[model samples]
Target: MNLRKEILVTGAAGFVGRETVKQLLAEGWKVRALVRTADTNPLAFHAGLSVQEVGDIAAVADWSSLVSGCDVVVHLAARAHKTGEGPNAARELFRRVNVDATVELAKAAAAARVKRLVFVSSAGVMGDFSARPFTEADPPQPASEYAISKWQAEQALREICRQSNMELVVLRPVLVYGPGNPGNLERLMRLVASGLPLPLASVDNRRSLLNVRHLATIIGRALELAEANGKTVLLADGNDLSTPELVRTFAKGMGIKARLFPIPPLLLLAAARLLGRSHDAERLLGSLQVDVTLKTNLFGALPREETLRGLIETGQAGR
Candidate 1:
């Protein structure tokens, strides 16, 4: 009988998925990468990796055969957030992909007798802004359809796991950033590269962010840590960077100078609100810190210099 521990990873082509699969392979775990398409798979060069093409994660039925025999399933696929979506439409779309699909996958994992299911959830489930660092004790108040869907999915998975006696580990990470990252981070990178004077110097809000590699490390640890079973924990770098600081750091990482000027927080908010961008205002001018001591205390702090180096490398990579 083969003694290797087998693991299944969904969304194997995504940023975090790619890194997680690579790290698992390096650690000698047999990885079954489930991706929507096999063509140009990032895991192609990886040795000893099993690739399964399961197009449209949300629509897939009968995951039992694929999940059978895997020790753990790391689920990372979901419907990405979009701008200017109506409440009803957004809810239904998010439910279709994030909630409905995830519950289906969890049911399959449970049926397969998988020991654990590590789910990648967003910190947005706690809302876009928080005056203080969010903790596990706080009740969820999801602010958007995407976040609401994730929150609902978490609840559903918890019940499913409870009923099936399967371990569920949910990780909520805030604003993951790395090379080739999309969303606001990529937009910020572009803005910084433009050398345009940004009126964010006076904004004194703390934002927590996670590096893709760091998140991957956490996922790996969750798979092995018995203490992590049946827990919902938040993941962050534990280093909070303000908007100005982030801009400066990103600029420095790119070997350029940041052009920034002080702008009143209230004024920024008013302008954003006027432009029908309250969400953008809150993200830019508000704080969304998360208490990540739970993971840091277990793994120790990721050195600031190491993280800065990663930022620089990511910036240089120009993605």
Candidate 2:
């Protein structure tokens, strides 16, 4: 696990992939970014990185050449959205990208004698957040197409590693947020910034979040430590924040008072169902938390507990 060795990063154009690549480059690692097209450049900001155009991982073309000189493979490419497409379409796309492509990549990595394969998995595979505080040991009860695909990918990767004798490390991170976040967190921030009254004050649910910097640091440490081999780690900032508190914190950080109305949870759920936005209700009202003690103890490093403060600071800086 020498920092000077080469590593192949799939989905290098993605949010987490971009940050991870930056960290790896900063550590003096040679990065070979696998992209779909030669023109699909990420925010590398002119950092000196080797780029390879391997179109559509599902096609299963020669990936051995891609990882020929790499010591590690970090798989970050997957279908990550939840809406717009139907469930069947989503499942099929995810299976192709997450499951089939991942297996093929691992096989190629093993063929290339790569030392480690790190898979970025989603915590949603643990199931909906109805229950607070889920751990890595919890039986996977994936409730959505996205979650199911991630779980299947993990299984496929493990089986491939078992047959090929390659080291596998799976990391499940919850709601990774940072300055350029583009998911639900960004949507909420936009709404809060508009000074509109949000009906999330009554939702008393706690959820775990990971800052991108912390996540990148954990990935780097996992690569360096051999003890992380054949292990699954759930990553979080070791702090849980309620929906109201999160919104209020963001609002206050933006120099505005939070305009929140405490609506009944049941009524909100019904409204969400009628509007075909049940995911929104589930996220705001559901209680899903994680314990990062195992990750901290294993790596001898802990994520900062000042998640809200960090978010505020980073978000404002970005603004």
Candidate 3:
């Protein structure tokens, strides 16, 4: 029943990757971390980790050598943000890193005889902004290039696993937030700290979120559970927070009062389009909540209130 064996973790320097490695080590697994750069001292504090410098996930030579003898491979690296690029360019970049490189690594891991491959995919692959909560059974209707790339990567891994007889477990996690989170969550916190009366209060859309610790724990369980093989799981905190509630909670967590303004969502969207920032508006005002019934049924229901409290406490301490 012990799944703790030699494991290779791609993107070991990243946020999720680092957390995964730490948790895996705590579970008494021999972890071999693949890093793009030689300067891995930041992650050198952990014991029983064999660090290897591999240039790019796609062009890395001898991937079989890196993963050979490993029992599992956890792929976590990808092109996350679009930045200031056109849709085509963004799609190409995502394809190169998220799709093509991911498939190559999965293939290499299977070739190396790795027992299981855990892919960290995004929940965004479910579809566009909608009022309905997405479940694993929902047909994928990817809206953006990033989502498409993730979908393609999932298919590639599934196909490779089918042919190579490798156990594949895919995880679709919602907006993962925690300490040291350097994404839109951080930006929102900063905005709240600025004491600006935001118009987002009127938008009543629920969103699912995952704390980093909970995500790592679920991943650990997935690695151990035999039934998780060839299964895709959606991971979330099981509590859907509205836009206003999230802002208020974040403010409360930081010991600050939120200056909220109730503004029409349609007007905000129009303004964002006029300002050439429709993407920002869509991400903030959009509705993309998910149903965690499958995850709860498989991993047991996570303590939602406790997890949210931990997130707030961690955020406050970090600030």
lDDT of 2 by residue, 1-319 (tens): 3456888999887788889989888887888887778786774653548887777878858788888988888988887775454434657888888888888888889998998999999888887674658878889988877889999989988988898868999999999888778778887788888888998888888888888878888887777588899999988888778888888877767888889998999999999999998777778788888877788777554434467777786556434
TM-score of 1: 0.95
1-319: candidate 3 lDDT, tens digit per residue: 2344788888888878878888888888888888878675357565678888887776775677887889888888787874465444656778988988887788888888888999999898997676688989989888778888999999988999999978999999998887777667777778887888998879988888888878888887887688888889888899878878888888778888778888899999999999998877887888888888888877777777866785686458545
Pick by TM-score: 2 or 3, better one: 3
Best by TM-score: 1
lDDT of 1 by residue, 1-319 (tens): 1327899999999988988998788777889899998886777566658899999988898889889999999999998765455433657778998999999999999998999999999998888789799998888998778889999999999999989978999999999888888777887888899889999989888888888898888888888788898788888888788888888878887888989998799998889889988777777888999998787865457777766777776777652
- Candidate 3 local Cα displacement, residue 127, angstroms: 1.3
Better candidate by lDDT, 1 or 3: 1
Question: Native-vs-model 3 lDDT?
Answer: 0.82
TM-score of 2: 0.92
In every candidate, how many clashes are there? 0, 0, 0
TM-score of each: 0.95, 0.92, 0.94
